[model samples]
Target chain A: MIYFDNAATSWPKPPGVTEAMVHFLEKVGANPGRSGHRPSVEAGRIVYDAREAVAELFHAPDPLRIVFGANATEALNLALRGLLRPGDHVVTSSMEHNSVMRPLRALEEQGVSLTVVPCSPQGFLSPPDLEGALRPETKLIVLNHASNVVGSLLPVREAGQIARRHGCLLLVDAAQTAGDYPIDVQTEYIDLLAFTGHKALGGPMGTGGLVIGERVPVDELEPLKRGGTGSRSEHEEQPDFLPDKCEAGTPNAVGLAGLAAGARWVLETGVEHIRAHEVRLTQQLIDGLREIPGVTVYGGLDATRQTAVVSFNVAGLEPSEVGLRLDEEYDIMCRVGLHCAPAAHRTIGTFPTGTVRFGLSYFNTPEEVETALEAVRAIARANK
Target chain B: MSYGVVLVPSTSHAIRAERVCHLAGLKVKLIPTPRQLSSNCGTALRFDWEERETVEQVLRANKVDYDEVHQLEW
Candidate 1:
């Protein structure tokens, strides 16, 4: 199967991922920090090693600041819901996942105002446009590192600088870019970063995190949950701290173990190489798809501006119908519909029907790309 | 091995549990509060031990207490 719907959740995770999870469940099954013993200590060791792996991958100075969650959506929820308050102003872009958009919209109930900067039709968000939307009351600027639908990467460093100039925090949803993209928290001045392990990271689902940078002051935001920390079992009140402030229960340790393994694999393999591989595959698909009559490819015209995702439409086929056909006849799997980012699709003028998105990954091969292209050609010809 | 369930009232309360797990060297997991178990927090921690009286002692010592310790099998 030519599995192209990786933006949703990557498939065929690294071989080591499941092994790591099983190892943890079988041998190191213990509640971290809930007790003091060999089992508990071993559990702590696993979690700590995971943190170190993440810290090393992202170049994050502190391992303690990396807070794990079920997925990027959950991490985004924690970052958005925990940090924003009534009367606060937030800025976002047209290219955000519903994971980021939905939570911010819910905050409207709290009187939090929002400004959504428009992106170029080719999927580029103009930092100047966002700067124009900035308010004196703007407390946070949320930017998706890459659009899940089109794979268009945003200019985060410039936008982060603007947020810093205004004393506002910059929150990045790195769902699509985390493992495939190299990011330095200090260099970009990003205050909060949310990443999922299921996508480019090649980890299993239910693994993601929110990185709280040193610059961001999150003290005022309320904890999403409160309970007995293994630390202060005697205290009924929940602890108010960074990871503790936002993290409220036992983490997804099995998923985290796999995610850590994935991150380590990315580090050892190098994101640059992964990125280069995807670019090569994407370009091949782009060239091949363009040759198919009645196929209209979408996203930035330049290959450098986008990642491995390629979105396009067949002239005569309904988006969903095309997806079904691809699966049934061509054995090609791709994502159809709004891709959970309606605004992005609307911005690209592909709302409702959305587009057929083929998201490539390092594991994909040149032969797979050629097969998908041939299948698209055959499908396009069927329309004739 | 030490065993306990660290219960929290809301989903957000797990952060403290995460901290305690990270700092105290415990294996922590976030599970929906088992309907059988009642607590102010809806999430509970399924700890990693068959027995550790000293683990409970440290929790009590550090003022980090739990709702109950059910010597449940893993």
Candidate 2:
């Protein structure tokens, strides 16, 4: 069976990921920062190493600013709900996942003004359009680095500069591009970056975080939840320091151990190499699918402008039917439906029924892509 | 023997100090925060008083957020 739905969650993670988690469970099984014992110290070290690894991946200045959470959704919530107050204005794009859209919607209802700039039919946002939407009251501009549905990359660097010019903070949702592409928070002038370890980072689920930049005044943003951070236990008020200021409870130490190893692997192997491999596979898949009759592919054919995700529709069949056929007959795994980004589907004109998504990964080979394309061709022929 | 205790304001900083010192090959032991020290963190790093300069240098280089370093009789 071929697995191609990496956008949802990556499969068959790097060998070191599971090994590291197991090592945590066996050798360093203690709550980090909760005790002063040797095991606890070792556990704290593992967590810190993961923080440093995440910092290195994003080129963040300080490791202490990396705050751990359950996933990108949680991280986004922390950033959106934490930073934006009533009467503050925000600018975002139409091609955002529910992770960003839901929180913004909730914030909008709470009297916070929101302006959603529409993306092109191909799911690319215009940086100038984003800048035009910003108001004097606009305190933040949040956007995803890449669309989860169409795989089109946004102009984050330009948007970051615009945000800086307007005195608004730029918060990037790097859910799909964190490990697959190179991102330097400093170079891009990003103020906050939210990422998930389970996807491109190749770690176990239940691990993700937000990396805060130096420009953001963290003290002003309220934490999503507050409790014992194993520091300032004597004081009922939460600690004002970073990491602890955002991280309120016992963290997912086991998952983080795996994340550290996964991040280390990405750094050692280099993101450029991974991006090249995925681009090659994506180009092959897109080219093959476009050649097949009755197979209408979405998104641009440019491999350099997108991640490995490709969406398509076959003639005379619903997306669900095609997905079922691919799974039962071809033994190929992919995602179908709106993909949690209804706004993206609307932008691409696949609103209700959605489309079949084949998200490639670094581990996927050209041979696998070829086989999947053949399966798609056979399905298209049958539908015709 | 005289020992040195490095007190930090938080557990995260203490953990960071330990890691920085350990990587630098400084002989440091993470012990409970002594009653004499007024710190919020539960743990503190204990090292030889003679190695104060070395520990300070390593922590400073690593940017480990520490509070105070005191010389105590053991």
Candidate 3:
């Protein structure tokens, strides 16, 4: 069976990921920062190392600024809900996932202003359009580094410059790009970066974080949830610090241990190498699918400008039906529907009924891409 | 002998203080921030009072952000 739904969640993580998690559960099963015991200290070390790894991956200056969360959704919630207040304005692209859009919508209802800059049909956002949307009241500019639906990359550096010029902070959702692409928070001028470990990071579920850049005043952002962070136990108020300010309660230390290993693997193997492999597979899949009759591929054919995600549709057949056939007959796994980004589907003119998405990963090979393409071709032909 | 406490503005800085001190051969232990110190953070680093000068130098050299260092009995 071939797995191509990496945008949702990566499968078959690196061996070190499982090994690290097992090691944590078996030998260092203790609540990190909750106690001063050996196991507790070990757990704390694991969590800290994971923070360091994530910080290194994103080029954050301080590891303590990286706050652990359940996933990118939680991190996004923390960033959006924590930073935005009533009457504040925010600018975001139309290609955002629900993780960014939902929180912004909720905030909009609470008197915050929102401006969604439209992306091109191919899923690219213009920096000028985003800058034009920025208002004097704009406090933040949130965008996904890459569209989960079409795999098109956003010009974050250009957007960041615009945001900085407007005195607005940039919050990037790196859910689809982290670990698969290079992101330096310093160079990109990002204020907040939300990433999930279970996706491109190759970790288990339940591990993700938000990296806070030095420019963003940590005290300005409110804590999404407040409770015991094992620090400031004597004080009822949440600790107003980098991570503890955002991280409340006992963390998922075991999952973080695995995440650290996965991030380390990405660093060791080098993101450029992993990206090259995925781009090769994506290009092959796109070129092959374009030749199949009755098949229409979305997004540009340039693999260099996108992640490994490929979306397409077959004439006279629903995407769900094609997905079911691919799974049942060809033993191929993929994602179908709006992919939690109806706005993106609408941008690409595939709303209501979305496209069939094949999200490849570094582990996938050329043979698997060929087989999946052949399956898609057969399905498209049969539908006609 | 009284121990020297290095209070930092954040937990990340406290952790960095520990790392830099260790590399500089100054023995330091991370503990809960004493109530006497600022309530800005939860974690603080404790080291020997004799190593206060070296600790300060090392942290400064390593660019660790710290609040203050107090020579206090623990």
User: Top lDDT: which candidate number?
Assistant: 2
**Candidate 1 residue-wise lDDT, A1-384, digit = tens:** 888888888887876888999998999998765654556656665766677677777788766678887888888888899888889999999988899999999998779998888998778898889999998999999999988888898999998899889899999999988888788888988888888889888788888888889886767766667765554444677765555656667877777778878888888899898888888888888888888889998888456778888899999899898899889998889989888999999889998889998988888999999988888888888889
lDDT of 2 by residue, A1-384 (tens): 999989999997976999999999998999999888789878988999999899999999778889999999999999999999999999999999999999999999999999999999988998889999999999999999999998999999999999889998999999999899999999999999999999999888999999999888888989999898988788999989888999998999999999999999999989999999999999998899999999889987788999999999998889999889989998999999999999999999999989999988999999999999899888888766
Ranking by TM-score: 2, 3, 1
lDDT tens digits, residue span B12-41, model 3: 566667776887888899887777876555
> Which regions in candidate 3 have their CA more than 4 angstroms from the true location?
B1-14, B23-49, B60-74
After TM-score superposition, the amount by which residue A377's alpha carbon in candidate 2 deviates from its true location, in angstroms, is: 0.4
Q: Residue A139: error of model 1 in Å? A: 0.5
| A265 Cα displacement, candidate 1 (Å) | 0.7
Best by DockQ: 2
Whichever of 1 and 3 has more TM-score, that candidate is 3
- Model 1 Cα lDDT, one tens digit per residue, B1-74: 44556664333334334555557776666665566755654456666674256546655554443556555544
Q: Name the regions of candidate 1 deviating beyond 4 angstroms.
A: B1-74
Clashing pairs in 2: none
| Ten contiguous residues with the weakest lDDT in model 2 chain B | B9-18
Give the candidates in order of lDDT, highest first. 2, 3, 1
How many Å off is the CA of A194 in candidate 1? 0.4
Residue A157 of model 3, lDDT score: 97
Error of 3 at A15 (Å): 2.0
